[model samples]
Target: MKKTGITLCLLAMSVGLTSVVSAQTQLPNSDFEDIQSISGVADNGGQPYNYEYDSLGQGWISGNPVNRYLEIDHIFMKDTSFTHSGSHAIVMRTDSIGPVVAVGNAGLGEFVFNESNPFASIVFGAPFADRPHAFAGWYTYKSVGGVAPSDGDDRLINGDSLLILCYLTKWNSTLEKRDTVALASWTSSETVTDYTEFMIPFNYFSSDVPDSANVMFLSSSLGYVADFSERPFGVKGSTLVIDDIRMHYSGAGFDEYAELNGTAYTVGKKVVVRLEELPSDASVRIVDMAGRNLVSRQLSDKESTFELAYSGIAFVIVRSEKGTLTRKLYIH
Candidate 1:
């Protein structure tokens, strides 16, 4: 139930400009290793003038409202004990002070808070022009069964869910608005005790090149209702720990092979891949929308078919020494 109206504010300012990146790019501070303390107190009498707040490192932004009226800080915290790699990771938790439940969220862009109307608008996205095929990362989630808001989506009433999402956008001069070129989103309610890898493929909506990219992680997907009220939605204890986020780009060899010699299609609950001449070291992997690998095997023949046990949107990936190619599939 996150609001999309705030995206209109992005038109007022130009984000940091950078050279167009074409290769696979790992976001700055993707590992959450750089920890820094940002000291600030709420401006509208939310806290004492002497109070200070610790925030995330550079290249990441959060809507924790440390400078706002609520002044919630527990939404984002540094975690060294439960990390996937390196010495640090971030744990985003659904936090509440009194009846105000703030959903834990961190992204790549900046946020603007209007203390007058009490509206927090986020200008989400950083300058980038790459059309990466997939967004990959590692994370662990622990959900505390909480009731969804009365006006929220019914599907989330059972419990809170963690969300990871990325989108590519371009400002359309003709339309005078931002156009979403591609998007990849994943949400899960299951409790994961150990860190698990995830790769979500972007679904292209337009053929136009992108000028900005945004990636975000949220501890509770149904906590948006608390934005305008002091009433809580999701449980305060639900948490998500994440580390090592990266973007996946298609290699040249994979592109050439796909255009000339390979083809992939879905038939019912199965995926069929055909390569005129399969490489000896090539392999095929099938993953669901949640980035869970369902099938992986070496390519022994020019044409191979794999039966899928689950049905939904899936990705068919072929990997070899030449490169990696991915195809989107829809199985009914």
Candidate 2:
């Protein structure tokens, strides 16, 4: 009897391990391509929207550049940066309009938008007609040489010239300014040969602001600007370069799945489908192709697996804090 019991226990252990592996194959995971790029600029020279450009420095669909020499610069955002990722970033060319760069210049160093000049706010175009986009670049400025001049209200990372930094809100459609870590001064203790790095937060779009707003405006006060003067100063000719611009959702999407119980689970066999990986605090629901909700539960912990009976071609949908995921399981 002892020998028989030991054999059964070993068999059960093997079955459990196999069940885990199988179930993992059945659960769904998230992918990045599903999300769309809300706003950005590329290099191939196609219009993302309706707009006109002139050599005199004016994108006709929007407004005219005060300076004749300045035009919206072009670049190709790198794939490793923002383009293929999930969120947003906006850049500006800070040189076109100002007296030694003024702070009060309308839409000087930010994504400025309004009903009258919507085009002036977010101008859209493509560098290549075939490719999606090449770059989404902008410009800003910061005081250099520790000079807090009268017009220098805000200081940016690239001191003494155009500040080239990417703001997170411009990419994340769901986020606002208050939830981001504004760019502060770029500190480099080394010589000109030394490299300077900025520690940008992965989830800068999720940070809190002074108010609970969906559209938060970042200024020099919020790391977007540094201590140059009482107010943030705009440094002209300062260009913030962003290439391979992409957004990162961080929110999980549907991936894969597996079966945990029996190959032919009997009716009322207490069928439980274990998740291979859980993304966030998710809510689970078992449904049919016809969109009928058969089962629902919240996944607070890994122990929160799905329990159902054998049914034909059932789908398990997990809606978490990040996003929704779906997986198919068979029942007999």
User: Against the hidden reference, what TM-scores do the models get?
Assistant: 0.63, 0.25
Top candidate when judged by lDDT against the true structure = 1
- Which residue segments of model 2 deviate by more than 4 Å? 1-92, 96-146, 151-199, 204-232, 248-332
For model 1, give the 10-residue run with minimal summed lDDT. Answer: 3-12
* TM-score attained by model 1: 0.63
Q: Write the per-residue lDDT of candidate 2 for residues 1-332, one digit (tens) a residue.
A: 00000000000000001111111111111111221212224344563443232211111111222221224331112233433233322222333223333221111122334344232342221111111101122222232334354644533433543222222222233552122222111212111211122232121212322111011111121122212332334333333322222222222331212222212122453445455566566566664322234576676654444455435555555555554444455555
lDDT of 1 by residue, 139-242 (tens): 89988875665576464567788878787778878877666666677778899989999887666655777888777777876553313533335667788888
The stretch of ten residues in a row with the least summed lDDT in candidate 2 is 5-14
Clashing pairs in 1: none
